[model samples]
Target: MSGQGPMRVLAAMSGGVDSAVAAARLRDAGHDVTGVHLALSAKPATMREGARGCCSVEDSRDARRCADVLDIPFYVWDLAARFREDVVEPFVAEYAAGRTPNPCLRCNEKIKFSAVLERARALGFDAVGTGHYARLSGSATGPTRPVLRRAADPDKDQSYVLGVLRPDQLDGALFPLGDTPKAEVRAEAAARGLVVAEKPDSHDICFIPSGDTRGFLAERIDEAPGEMVDPSGAVVGHHRGVHDFTVGQRHGLGIRRPAPDGRPRYVLGLEPVSRTVRVGPVEDLDVTTLSGADPVWLVDPPSGPLDCVVQVRAHGGTAGATVRVTADGVDVALAEPLRGVAPGQAAVFYRPDGGGDVVLGSATIAATA
Candidate 1:
């Protein structure tokens, strides 16, 4: 850790205030920084109907302007082909398979860490950086054993989305604004006259700018009307497609009649083979144990069944649990029953220390008991 040369870093600029300030912080820290914007969207015919999300053309221009203000070299890399393949395609496939998938997690895994980082390493950069609101501290042994931590700004902490990062990826990642609050970051950018200083944070899913997943999926995948059944195997309603429903979804169910008990019915499960959506009482949503595949551990694997907190979704409250780790992943039994534990959603594990280091990586929830 003593006197290592200023790290050659590539900052992923999304043309937003957060990323712009992140890049500025890295430059101010004396790191040799370069900015690159991933061109994820293709050009639209009209500006008014443009894709204006995080990866939109307007954001890319903002990134360029921020890079210029920082006096750093910047480039636009076309990742549209790969983004579509890695993020958009699988999104459709998951829905086709009748499982709701987290496209943001896929983007972090396939695009940011996989494709972009690979390109950065190939270009001889020592590390890659992003505007994510997370922190990374070098391991006791140095950068080779990096530890992922949460951002100082809890409201903007992106550790949930980034919990899937691997050790090697962490080794070559930098989050210069991790310890700084978002407001201060914007203040710093404004004081420095950066153009993106006042831009609002992009909240919608980037690729689906219209935020109409149902319409989007219907356009991409063929839809055949499917039966909606009650928990007792009685046909209660019909659905456009099994993919259009989720575990706790209530609206657009098309079930006009109320349940006999006067309590509302919710989507309890999706049967892909039968193409049926099962509706049941809200109590049907409660679950105690969850087991899944393809687990990614941030720290060393747990020696034995260990106690930790499990989060079934982003911003979901942490629940007490005993986690049993196997070669593939971990199985968790919640201390108290939880609702909305859906398949294909991420379950992230955290140590009780409050450091925001994801001791265990997130996984798509495979099952709930």
Candidate 2:
């Protein structure tokens, strides 16, 4: 919190409890703060018109109210044009290619850190802060400085989704609620009389309000009905589309061949080119190693082999792995076999010291072995 002047800070408020509380904290800390609500896309009529959630018109008003209570200026910036070109389009395209894309990661990378952050800088703001549950630290020397750490409340830590943040972005970023638990943050909001204090956490992607991603994709992408085949290439059933399924998925496969021992068959692979969904027993799904491409380093890249834990997805648990910073990307061989490593998911590396600092950056899941 040092080396910062009495400067302007733009706080990205998502009309959620955490972000509202973050804006209040920045105001209390004596910095000139402004609340910015990013309008992601057009409002859907079925969305109950005034729901104070992200991407909804109601949410923008809630953000304005929080700014009002904190006595800070508030504005709504339309980034839908860039959002479609950057996050939404890429998401649809990736899924069409049979990859399970992480749109939240894309939103953070292209929108929050790149577009919105740039806008803040252009407005003469010193830094842009958000309610993200991550911490940043380093000497305040240059733009390319700082290390990203997990929030104090491990249960609420969001560092995994933020591994894409560059060192320069981290230097100008602040997470006011990083050290506060969700319950405490809510309590502070209520004590301060904020309306969204009791609002539920926004979980689903903002654009797809109904959480029916398969349906959304069906409307957007041309469908090629595929066949469900066993590993031996025997046809089991028909699938609507291979893009709707992922590795280790069991429930929705429509194929009802009972297991010899009364177990359930899980999807083991997706062959997009062959237009087949490969199903097998659970043991066949175990993956002992994963290769990722285009890895970015948060701290300086490690010179040699380093031991750390890796998380393959946002909420996935950590697995023990030996991490080597390769010229192409990070190579991680899991000490224990992991199941369900899907392409296009994030694989984030964490320090073993439990400081919760993200040592390396995010990578696209490339191959599973």
Candidates in order have lDDT scores of: 0.80, 0.81
Give all TM-scores, in the order shown.
0.93, 0.94
Off by over 4 Å in 1: 1-5, 44-52, 139-144, 354-358
RMSD of each: 2.4, 2.1
| Total clashes for model 1 | 0
Give me the runs in candidate 2 sitting further than 4 Å from their true place.
1-3, 44-53, 139-144, 355-357
lDDT score for candidate 1 against the true structure? 0.80
What clash count goes with each model? 0, 0
